[model samples]
Target: MSVRSSAGRVRCPVCARPQAQCLCSLIPRLWPPTQLLVIQHPDEASHALNTARLLVPGLVNAHLLITESLQEHPAWMRRLQDPRWRNELLFPGEQAQVLLPAAVDLRPRRLVLLDGTWRKARKLVYLNPVLQSMAQVCLPAGLVSRYRLRKVPQAGALSTIEAGAEALSVLHPGFDKHALLAPFEALIEGQIRAMGLARYQQNYGAASDPAVE
Candidate 1:
């Protein structure tokens, strides 16, 4: 058989299924009313196998924002006009905390997700004056990051999907966050395995593996 025949019709590197015949629907759904917006660094968008993409299927009101600068993006201006919503940037700082939307009286229930490397994330905050004024929510957990493709400055830094699920669970309890998170974790793990990064499959590539390094 030719290589094309061997690989099947546009096979996915991870699930070994065709792009249109994906088993993603076999996974559960976590449809929260809370609006989710993911802002990705341009570089991350190019290089990432990005677990964040899985989120769009599960979320009812989610959007992906990509730009070199948050301040210059036209979407930033449009989102601001949404009077029914209030936003919070998920970051780690002295002020970061878990805040309920009701506690802040933020309407339309908004969450602005940042999907990028640690350096890019720092830049997102440093360059965007609008993000500075928003509330900052930090995750409080003993969990380390689940991303194995890139190195992070801190263990607390999590992948885009993991961070979003954690934040939503905090904002709304019993929100079936696992439905969204499990599939994402599987997808990430599958990608690492397909790339022959067995260390990533085992323990997020933390287990002293030269191949992943």
Candidate 2:
């Protein structure tokens, strides 16, 4: 077996996206009221299609951390204990409350998102007791995911970028959710273009697929 090296591929030094699909220019410099913290599984860090990387550049206060276990990182644990930032986990579990305006506490905070496949994300939460103790929340119902490049496990499941954008929208009502999604949509469109319409539709489903758009 052989592995391909990205060194040969022309990529943007900053966003790390391939030159053709680089979103650095499209990313906004606005800082949202709330901080975005994406805890990505090590496996997802180098995935060509991962959307978590697209998030940081769009929001000034956002950050992405790659680690398999939160318990292994003392800094993250300290951040969780920090009084200045209210830490909340964005996950869809039985204990997770709806992230609606009335249901959530919109205080100065760091919204933690697990960036990985469904199974991997669950493993992360299960392994970290600190994450279990934190308040967990889910996006409001009736919202569809626009991450068309990959197949989602469920209908309402959103990509990391989409989830972060929605969290920002809920936390900061003044922010424009559409603007946040613009670059995300571009990333999907770029993939679709690279794969060609037919192949993209075959792998990700048709444009009419409810999960798409």
Candidate 3:
């Protein structure tokens, strides 16, 4: 079997990518009206491809919580239950509404995003009743994901950082969402270059577009 990566590469303390390809410069420090709570699944917490790890440090007030359940974290549970801020979950479902700038209230808000695969995100939502109780929102239609490194089975699916950027921009319309995506795009391009043209073409670009995000 082929190994995807070396076990002991020196990784950047912030973005967690290899030190040579550290994405710290590309990451911006931005503050939005809403506080971000990125709930990452424990299984992928240490994965090199994990975007949630990169995202939390970029934003000034963002926090990353790696857990399968919320009941264990009393502080986070209280924040989620905080009556002052509106709690919103960035996930799509039959009942999910499109996340729009006009739709979001100006009041302080708590945006909860699940960082994991579709299945794992579903499982997180199922396991946490507080996540289920929050208002669920989806990204606008026709948004193409720039995360070419990952194959998303679902169309219009975005990586966690991508979703966070878009959602934050919509929540606070003044900031450009693309600033947040610079490091993410840089990471993808670096990985693609490392994979080489032949391998990337064979694995990612065999189709007219890509398979998906």
- For 1-213, candidate 3 gives per-residue lDDT tens digits of 112245867777778777778888998898887789999999887877788866888789899999999999989988888887788899998889998764645567878999988889999999999999888989898777788877787889999998898888876777767888788877877777777767887987645333223
Ranking by lDDT: 3, 2, 1
The stretch of ten residues in a row with the least summed lDDT in candidate 3 is: 204-213
lDDT of 1 by residue, 99-134 (tens): 554675747777887777778887887887777777
- Of models 1 and 3, which has the larger lDDT? 3
- lDDT score, candidate 3: 0.82
Off by over 4 Å in 3: 1-6, 102-106, 206-213
Better of 1 and 3 by TM-score: 3
TM-score of each: 0.74, 0.87, 0.90
After TM-score superposition, the amount by which residue 116's alpha carbon in candidate 3 deviates from its true location, in angstroms, is 0.5
Which candidate do you rate higher for lDDT, 1 or 2? 2
Q: What TM-score, to 2 decimals, does candidate 2 have? A: 0.87
lDDT, residue 15, candidate 2: 63
- Write the candidate numbers in order of decreasing TM-score: 3, 2, 1
Q: All models: lDDT?
A: 0.68, 0.79, 0.82
Residue 168 CA error for candidate 2 (Å)?
Answer: 1.0
